[model samples]
Target chain A: MKKKLYDLAHSRAGDKGNTLILSLIPYDEADYPLLCEKVTPDAVKHHLKEIVLGEIIRYEMPNLASLQFVCHQALLGGVTTSLSMDTHGKSLSYAFLQMEIEV
Target chain B: MIRIGSGAGFSGDRLEPAVILAEKGELDYLVLECLAERTIALAQQRKNRDPNSGYDPLLEKRIDLLLPILKEKKIRLITNMGAANPIGAAKKIMEMAKRKGIHIKVAAVTGDDVLEHLDGQQEVLETGKPLSKLSNLLSANAYIGADALLPALESDAEIIIAGRVADPSLFLAPMIYHYGWSVDDLDKIAQGTVVGHLLECAGQLTGGYFADPRKKEVPDLARLGFPFADVGPDGTAVIGKVEGTGGFINLATVKEQLLYEATDPTGYLTPDITADFTTVRLREIGSNQVEVSGGRGRPKPATLKVSLGYHTGYVGEGEISYAGPNAYSRAVLAGEIIQERLKDQFPDLRIDHIGVSSVHRTYFGELREPYEIRLRVAANATDSENAAIIGEEVEALYTNGPAGGGGARKYVREVIGIVSTLIPREKVQTQISIQEC
Candidate 1:
């Protein structure tokens, strides 16, 4: 079945400087390996290409069924200088959740 | 077990919830973590104008509300209320205690400010630009760690005010003081950091910010209770909130907050220790009780993160609304008209369709033909007067250009942005002074 990543997992967004960190945590423990395989740094970078300008780095934690992505240069100039309405990039998690995955 | 309650997560957090925690939490320490990176720069500017006014705006209200309870309960207080003026805030707290006829001692932790120390030759970590390039440097403070705040614990004061210490360090210093934990105890320090991280956001782990209607409905959010932790001797912690209060705690909320702003799970760096969150474990042992363990640690980072705030020009913004038959088209027309109008004066002006391209910069799926739309134009310029031109040009569209354009609002303000760089630990000094009422 084709499902939105939101249905398979839940995520949160936080930022430091010009970088945004998104944590992709699955709703079920059984989906850990699926995320580990499907949700690569490239996939996330492509998913959020519009706002993300720099490189993307992903780290995994199998025990917690979670993946954390550090998206570089995502915020225009970060919270201090960003002209965007959503300065902190808090809403980017929903954009990440809108990604599709086959289950 | 030592109980520590997170009173205020940020500088502007609710004061009533903190008062509730002080009264009923049975906590030995009430730690309020305020002072975001940019808050100090703003505070420093206020201090420049008036020597004693640069502290937290709600410092007086927070202390006033929790004073009686804190005194009666004998709960020690620790907070970074001293954004740019720890001594000023401490004096204010002392006056409050004295006016209330209570004998309480206040400790002020200082030495985080390094604006005078910078030789204007260092490189900024974010942009790699030399500090000399930035003409007006507003403020620069090192992220002091647990070691700087540990001395405040040794004082016989009931409340400790700090300036620019790391948020986690505020909660970790209490655990270190109580347990007499050795500086070499990486495992314990990491555990303490994890506990601090979890509780540092106050109600975040207690179902306040995690609620999502039917998906994750929380009970009685109207009176959401703040969070508290009971730390064991081994550095493990069990998180909970005040009994009979609102908000719920479970594995989900704990997990969400665990990775809140943390970049590296394996190596969450603080000045006291490099915390490893990968090995950390969480279990909902009971209602609103989650046992947290498995936080390991490595050596602390050699350099401390320095937040430097500088002048970043002025922001001029104008927002106008369009509605009825073809609101989206009218808003788009307004955007184009404004673009053409301001291209000569402000070449870099940005136009955003509020409901469409403003958020993610692209609207997904078929548009429902937005019944109402808002057109926003913004530009950064050398000064406020120049920035106001972007709004003036947009307001000119009220009768000159687009049809049905109304509700135009314009604003121009100064902008201050932050850049970070690391400084060696030895160059900075931290101090603690006590004042009794």
Candidate 2:
């Protein structure tokens, strides 16, 4: 069955300069491996291609059932210089959650 | 065991929660981590304008409100609210204490400001440009760590304030001072760092930012409680909030905050230690208590991160609202008109339909016709005059382009850009001064 990542996980986005640090944690620890296979750096890069304009790196934490994605050149120019209404990229977490994957 | 509670998370966090922590949480120390990346730079700019006023604007108010409770409860306070001007902040606190007839000891930690140490030959981590290339540099302050704060804690000053200390260090320093944990004890420092990271955001660990209506319900969110950690000698702690308070302190909230802004979990760097969060463990032992353990780390870095704030330019923005039938189209047309008018002069101008595609720069989910839409146009200009023109053009739309335009608003703001570089730890000297009232 296909399900939105939002259904399986929750996320939070944080910014550091021009980079975005996003954490994706599945509700069920059993689904950790599933997300590990499906939610690759390439997958997230493609999912948020319109907004994130740089390289994406994913680090897996199996114990916590979480995946940390570091998206570089992502915040337009970060909080200080970005002209976007959402200067902090606080809304990007939901945008990442909008991804659909096989459940 | 020592109980440490977080008072304020950022510069503008709610005040009552810290008061609650000081009063009812039976805390030994209440740490308020207030400074952010650009915060000190902004403070420095304020200091440049007025040498005596660069500390947190709310420092006096927060101290004024919490002083009596803290004094009565015997809970010491450690805060970076002294941002850009710890001495001024300390002096102000002493004056406030004197006026209230409350005897108090306040310590100010200084020397985080290293603006004179830079010769402009260093590299800016973000732009890959030499520091000399960046113009209108406002301030440069190193992110000092737990060690720099040790002398203030050792001085036994009831209120300790500083500028640009790393967020977690504000919480961890007390743990080190109380537990007698060696700075070289990487594992212990890491454990304390984990606790600090979890509790530093104050209400974050207590479900302040986690409520999601039907999805993730947080009870009595109207009066969310802050969190405290009961730290034992072995660097293990149980995180909880005041019972009967508004928010919950369970495993979920702890997990979210553990990685809040921790970019790389494995190598979360602080001046005291390189914390590794992957080894940490969390267990919800009670209704509103979680036991956390197994935090590990490596040696501290040789250099400290220095946040550099510089003048970027100015941001001009204008927003106008439209409603009723064809509001979306009208908003789109209004945006196009502004774009067309400014395209030649402001080539990089941006137009956003607020109800449609503003935040993410694109829209998702089912595309239902919005009953109302807001047209927003913004751009960056080298000068305030050029920036104001963008907003003026949008205001002109009220009479010239859109038919139902209302609630038109415009803004012009100077942009301060923050970047980072590294300075040797030895180059930065920390000093502690104490005042009593």
Candidate 3:
């Protein structure tokens, strides 16, 4: 069955220069491996393809049951330069939650 | 164990929460992490206009309110509220102390401002753009680390003021000073950095920004308590909030903040140490209590990160709301009309339907007929007049375009864009000076 990523996990996004770091943490420790299998860099890259301009890199920490996706060239130019109201890309974290995953 | 409480997370974090901590947390040091991108630039500009007014705007109010409570509680303060002018901020605090007929020692950490030494030689990290390209550069500050702040901890300064130190370093410096930990203690420093990062956001680890209704179920969010750390000699700390205060402190909140703004879990770079949060563990020892351990660290970077601010022209934005049936269509029509009118003048104008496509513009998912929608048009340009034209075009939509378009708002402002680069550590010098009260 298809389930929204938000149903299984919670994430937070923060900006650095022009990159957006989205950290995904599963609610259930048992579901961590499932997230590892389903939420690939390619999946996230394709999921946020509209705004992501550069490459996406994922760093996994099974110890913490969390994954961090570094999305480069994601912000218009980031807080100091971006014209977006959400210049820090604070709202972009939810964009990852929109991903559909089979649980 | 030395208790360190975060009084203010950002420049504008609520003060009431910090008051709660001062009265109850039994903190040895209350660190306030302020100053974010271009904040120093704005502070520098203010100082240029008036010599005495370059620090955090709320510095006086914060000091005035927290002085009696924190002083009686013996909770010394260390803050980056100096923004662009540390010495000036220190002097102002001293003056405030004098007026209140109180005796206090204030120290200012200076030399982070390296605008004069930039020489336009460094390249911006984002665009590989040279610093010489900016004609109207305002301020440039090197992110000095925990070492610069050591003298303040050593001295008898009741309040320490600093400008542009790395945010995490504010919390780490006091930890290093209190624990008598050597600068070379990478592992301990790493652990200290972890605590700093966790508490640096103030309430994030305690649930100020984490509530999502049924998804997260944070209680008493209205009175969300700020975070404090109970650090042991080895730098292991338990992160929690005050008793009977609002907000939840748990593993989920910690995990969320753990990776917040993190580039690499194993190599989260800071001026003091490169911390590894990969092995960090969180345990709920009690209600509103989570012990954090296992954070490791490595040697510091050879160079320091510099935040450079320059004039980036102007930005103009306009928003008009549409409600009732067909709100989305009317909002879309308003957006199209504004774009069509201003496309020639402001070729880079962006139009977004607030409810339909403001953020994450890609996936609108079937349009679901929002009861209300706001059409926003924004553009950036080299001149304020050109930017203002973008908003003017949008405001004209009130009578010329979509029906039921109300609540029009338009604004044009100067843009202070920030660029970052690396500077050799030896090029900058840091110092701490005590204000004669």
lDDT, residue B60, candidate 2 = 83
Worst 10 residues of 2 chain B by lDDT: B250-259
lDDT of 3 by residue, B1-437 (tens): 98999888888888788888999888989988888877888999899899888999889888988988876888889999999999999988888889988888898999999987888878888778888876788889999999999998899788999999998999999888887899899999999999999989898989877889888999898898998999999889998788988998999999998899998888989999999998798888998889999889889999999998888899999898999999988888888777777788777788887887787765535658889988888898899888888777777888998789888888999988888889999999999999756
Better of 1 and 2 by TM-score: 2
Compute the DockQ of candidate 2: 0.78
C-alpha DockQ of every model: 0.73, 0.78, 0.79
Could you give the interface RMSD of candidate 3 in angstroms? Answer: 1.2
Q: How would you class the docking of model 1?
A: medium
Worst 10 residues of 3 chain B by lDDT: B358-367
User: What docking grade applies to model 3?
Assistant: medium
TM-score of chain A of each: 0.95, 0.97, 0.97
Per-residue lDDT of B1-437 in model 1, one digit per residue for the tens? Answer: 99999988888887788988988889999999888889999899899999988999999989889888988999999999899999999999988888999899899999999988888788888768888888789999999998888888898689999889999899999899999999789999999999999988898889877777766789988888999999999889999999998999987788888988887888998888999999998888998999999899999999988899888889999999998898999999888888887778776788899987797777655678877889999989999899998888888889886789899999998888889888888889998888987
Give the interface RMSD of each candidate: 1.0, 1.0, 1.2
Residues A1-103, candidate 2, lDDT per residue (tens digit)? Answer: 8899988888888888888989988888888899999999998898898988999989898768788999998888888888788999988889999998876
Clash pairs for candidate 1: none
The reply for model 3, stretches above 4 Å from the true place, is: none
All candidates: TM-score: 0.98, 0.99, 0.98
